[model samples]
Target: MKKNSLILSVLLVGITACSTVTIKPEGQNKLVNKPTYQDSKPFYLWGLSGEHRVDVLKVCNKNEPLQMQSQQTFSDGVLALITLGIYAPHTVKVWCPKEES
Candidate 1:
């Protein structure tokens, strides 16, 4: 029905609007094609009480990351929405420099 369509449309818009991406530049011309590591960070109380810390050195095997990205993906947004903002999560990605030849 029209009501169902409207609800779906609103949800789609909300999920798309919630996505956010932040990239940190490390002065590298090229980065690895794939992420060195990817994981979801969990937070409680609408992200007010949990720590968002990623051990880049550990993740990159002691190498510096060429770039780092944190994003609120569609799945992340859905999880938060399901929890009614009580639980929030973010996806983090890191790209390491290519191994020296």
Candidate 2:
């Protein structure tokens, strides 16, 4: 039980520590709402190569997103751990600017 607890704690710390966030300069003061789009991006060979381009504008219907964030979630971390760093994935989230009233 103690060993399981230690592993769980370590995983939680790793997942949290790997989180990343980016806010566009133009959208700095924009009100942040729910994410407009979310997806998991796959990378191979320990993230050395893959389709890293995420079309935020296309996902946001040609409008640039106010913010974009990419991070390794618990599942992403688990998969990477299971694959021994061979296959890795990250969760991507985009927040689009609110429509003008």
Point to the candidate with the largest lDDT. Answer: 2
Count residue pairs with overlapping backbones in model 1: 0
Distance (Å) between predicted and true CA of 89, model 2?
Answer: 0.4
Write candidate 2's Cα lDDT for 1-101 as tens digits. 99999999987577444656666676376445778888898998767778777888888788877788887777787787788778889888888867776
Q: At residue 93, what lDDT does model 2 achieve?
A: 85
Summed backbone clashes in each candidate are 0, 0
lDDT of 2 at 66: 79
Per-model lDDT: 0.76, 0.77
Against the true structure, candidate 1 reaches a TM-score of 0.71
- CA shift at 49, candidate 2, in angstroms? 2.0
